[model samples]
Target: MSNELYIEKNGAIATIVINRPQKKNAFTLAMFKELGALLDELETDKNVKVLVVRGVDETAFSAGADISEFLEVRFSAEKAKKYNDFALESIEKLYRFSKPTIALIQGLAIGGGLELASSCDFRFAAENSKLGITAANIGIVYNLTSTKRLYNLIGLSKTKELLYTAKLISANEGKEIGLIDYVYSSEEIEEKCFEFAKQIIQKSSVAISGMKKVIQSVVDGENEESEAISEIILASYCSDDYKEGIQAFMEKRKPNF
Candidate 1:
């Protein structure tokens, strides 16, 4: 409902922009609710084939939680949990989103910002971007889900090194360490993201959606050969999208999936 988290749709692509440039797009408690609501809507929106989460400008993806609110809103453990619940809702929604999701990082994706990017299926960073998990610097422990996501990206040793040092790494270094997927020049990052999205949008949405779940299951340490995985595979094979894919290959033309 608030403009802090707003959606802009172009055809089947939906971009959720964090609008708090004055604070480098740092998220507030209310903004998290708005983001969660948007994610909920997009999750069930069949028309949305791809989703991109980005900051309002090239200044930053997000600087993490607004600590300014801590004194008034999260001073106690009870209040802290409630504050965390809002963030967890939004982050988990993004992490478990069925469709393809991308975090287009520009500059200063630190602390919770890095965690947010880790939740996406892909992270595309601008060449000038800086990324790190800064909770340790402030004497706070990262949440389990966020820790798991970060661990999945950079592994145990690097995760330790990152949390211990709380140092910012360049976009290229982030990509090398598996924290980010791709990096482009600052001026070209947004355009490159759309180009990447176009490649995904041309595929079979049903197949992609199914695979995303299966892959996430594996990432979560679920058995890939389990009955649930089989069911998902069977459903995809039985889908019209599968037939279209086969037919298009035989016909030697592009598939309109």
Candidate 2:
């Protein structure tokens, strides 16, 4: 009912915060709708080259969906399906977002929270954080699309082990299993995540976006159309960024790619 989702802009980066700290940032129906709309706005905002998602407090990224609302709104089979569809739309929007995305995990990323992080291009968590996919414990089933996203990042075996057991794994274990890209001390997580994003922004956005599309196509088992690949290559070659990159190299200067 409140402004559960907050957006903050920092130059080329945008941070989306799940703001209901008292509930461990548990997402409500309104929060899901707000997230979808925010993501839609970001998609057309070319100045935003990177996006970071995080919880307001350091205790939890999101405990899960708002359980209190479930009884009243998602109790029936038909309503549950509709609810799932609405939540899934927001998740999918993040999954296919054009620019690079990072999950700045400060604490527990559980259930739907983990699914949300998995949708991002990269995840960086604090050393003391824990993550798990716990649909089994709640007597609900994870949708096929969410399962595919998790499987693609961590492999089917690891995905199954996490889901079937419904156990929380440490940040270290998450990194070992490829669930998280990097882990940092709680004291340094925010700075570290922004540093990582800055490094990524120094690279060619055109190339980064092209690779994202190719990776998504491969994950979706779509045919790699030669024409599409050719277009990407040609567009990158012709962009002003490409010219600046080459001239900067010849001049021994850092490229503003």
lDDT of 1 by residue, 120-202 (tens): 99999999999998887777788888887888888999999889899999999999999989999998999999999989999
Lowest lDDT sum, 10 consecutive residues, model 2, at 221-230
User: Which has the greatest lDDT?
Assistant: 1
Q: Which candidate is the best by TM-score?
A: 1
Question: Residues 1-257, candidate 2, lDDT per residue (tens digit)?
Answer: 25788788998899998998899888887788889999999889988889999999798888778888999879999999888889999999999999999999988899889889999999999999989988898798878998888888789899999989999999999999899999999999999999989888878888888888878787778776568876987898899889999999999999886
Q: Evaluate model 2: give its lDDT.
A: 0.89
Show where candidate 2 strays beyond 4 Å.
Answer: none
TM-score of candidate 2 against the unseen true structure? 0.95
lDDT of 1 at 13: 96
Residue 181 C-alpha lDDT in model 1: 93
